[model samples]
Target: MYETKTIKEKIKLFFIIFFPILITQVSLNLMTFFDTVMSGQAGAIDLAGVAIGSSLWVPVFTGINGILLAITPIISQLLGARSYDSLAKKVQQAIYLSMILAIIIIILGGLFINPILNMMNLESEVRFISKYYLISLGLGIIPLFIFNTLRCFMDALGQTRVSMIIILIALPINIILNYLFIFGKFGFPELGGIGAGIATSLTYWLTSILAILIIHKMKPFKEYQVFSAWVKPKTKHWKEQLKIGIPIGFAIFFETSIFAAITLLMSEYNTNTIAAHQAAMSFSSLLYMIPLSVGMALTITVGYEVGAKRLNDAKAYGYIGISGGIFIALLNGMILFLFNDYVASLYNSDPDVIALTVQFISFAIVYQLADAFGAPIQGALRGYKDVNMTLIIALVSYWGIGLPTGWLLANFTSLEPFGYWVGIIVGLSTGAGALLVRLRYVQKKYDKQQNPSVD
Candidate 1:
């Protein structure tokens, strides 16, 4: 029987886990903003290319990211039970198994970059620029895979701060690279869009190498098979990971693809509108990191408790995380809404772009709120390893509601750009509601077993 933690303790645990992840997320997401701004400074055509290129390949990366990220929760759960053998196999298997998948994505994304851009019907300049960015982006896929694996390892072992430090250390270097390459300073070529990709790629590789070094040298964590030379992939065990990971991949893909699909759909509105929309989306995603990190911590704590057969603790932690998320989201949404104009200025300078961005901020605000409500609920589910059904919920909410509403509002209705945002709000709310209901039912049922009445 596990004792439940007080709300204050849960909040403290959440933040200790959150600040590090928040730092990591702020660095990671800033890359997106910086990537666009550097390219935008080069030309609108450069920015357009990035948009198109991102639309084409982001879903692919989402699938890969989700699968690889599965390692974290698995390791978290296993650690709860002190199962070092299972943890070692899972870590080793994930590292070796993911390399093959990453290579496939690299090759496929590399090969089809041009064709995909053309298919999107972007301008010739945009297509060319997109191809350049895609090549560098594709080249960086393996490095990202390696980096994420290490981050997951560290995060699972309860030191999410290590990943944050690596990201922060690499950030200054990334910024310098972009400045030099994008503008052709210091006798370097004006690589433009390619420069943004190259800078990001270099950062990925650098951070990954540093994570490798940390894992090898760190106390407590270095004893695992992941660090041992003899820890090779046992092919038979790949299925075990795939079972947990594949659904996660599709779960992530389902949500991310909806965004990508909407972006492509939104392009038909107007370039300025699309540009403003993208800017707001980027800012919103960055703001989203706070609640997202909260959700991640919830997933970790819930998994740990559940693994230890402390179901009451797991359920209590889930509510605490979710409540904290709501509070954080409301505060964040208000600030972002209040500072919409100033926030938009951080990314681009054009007045026309800034004007469109204001409306986009409203949508972004709603997403932050809805994400707070939904994300932790989903996080708890992930902690429970109930992935397949969540994918179904996402599919229905996103495709069934989100896609159609966006299309109607953006194209057919008088809402124009606001309609597009409204569509997102509706989608997020629907998904958030469904997820909450499911979480309640699941938690309640599980708690009965974990906390049965004495006869």
Candidate 2:
């Protein structure tokens, strides 16, 4: 179905898919933004607690989500190949995998909570609130994964609007709940920062439930037969997903952990610093969704081409995705560069927080451009089912290089928070360069196969 389109048509199609995912991603980030904003209202300590607690679970959940993302390409490829019969089984297996991983993450989150907090040696109030927040948020992990599984299944089948709408609806719901729970309005108890976690958990549950109902009732998904039969967990399918997914998970873990670690490292500086970092990180994360959404759509687009044995078309999609992502990043970066302080003020009113936030945002502008190159290519590689090497590259660029540089500059040198920001810029640039080179190699290899030398 996708093989005959011109590059322009394909790029258009990519954006059609990309925008809905962007909306969904934006809403998800806004959920956190609202949480942080509400927490900030409570106090700086409350804001810090939410930020710290979120750092703990963002890596865990992002990693797990990355693993489950294997399902999208898997299904997209099958759809392209017209292998309709296998779709149901693949989706069911994805659900099984998501469920298992969700349980493990929740358990591990609970087990290590105390020790990790103690080791950090945070102030008593921040530590206490952070613990409660993590525990509350942990309860929602299962639902979060379930929603992701369903979303991936729908996305692979070229149905993204439903998930976007559902999430958007949940956004207002989340805001209201946050206000009620955090401030103890509407007859709800005032739980402060922990309220943000409670609100988020409930929001996930609501959205996941809504997603399931939509999938069941929606006419478009009827042909895939996702829920037709109860299939036992197939070891072969499990390994297939893990083999493809584990590396992607680790890659995400490596990347997210560095950011999380940086947030933790900043905790020693002062409450205002950590809060400012969180504010800056939050905005950058939202901007990141633009390319990330495009990249995700690229995965589906390229996966479909490869499955249909259209290598040239896959190459075209990759080029368009990379170029489009960079263009978008450049535009967003300019906005951040021009309005760093103004943007920072949106999160908090404190002058100190705003000043540091503007500083952090300067580094963010460069990294966003760098991420534009790496993130889409990473998605393209996933579509090509070449994830293992990407994982290695992520590890080397982020932890092996980025973290050490950031640590030395921040802890040992005069740069402090600025050092960590510099390290992030370096890490993203390294990853972008490497991923671009790798994508070029893959594309060239495919080109050679499609057209041999005349000599």
- The lDDT values for all models are 0.79, 0.88
Q: What is the Å distance of residue 206 in model 2 from its true position?
A: 1.2
Compared with the true structure, the alpha-carbon lDDT of candidate 2 equals 0.88
Return the top candidate by TM-score. Answer: 2
Which lDDT value does model 2 have at 262?
90
RMSD of each: 2.2, 1.5
Residue pairs that clash (backbone atoms under 3 angstroms), model 1: none
Weakest 10 consecutive residues of candidate 1 by summed lDDT:
1-10
List model 1 lDDT by residue over 1-455, tens digit each.
Answer: 12246867766776777789889988987886788877777877777777666666667887788788787778878877877776766777788877888888877876776665566656677778778887887667787898887788788776888889999999889899999888889999998877888788888888889988988887666877466765666877777767777887887787778778877776666666767777787778777777777777777888888777777778888888888889989998889878999987765678988888887897788777988888888778888877788888888887889878887987788887678678777888999999988898787777776667622
* TM-score list, all predictions: 0.95, 0.97
Off by over 4 Å in 1: 1-5, 451-455
Tell me the tens digit of each residue's lDDT in model 2 across 178-275. 99989999889999999999999999999989988887778788666777876999889989999999999999899888999998777778888888
- CA RMSD (A), model 2: 1.5
**TM-score of model 2 vs. true structure:** 0.97
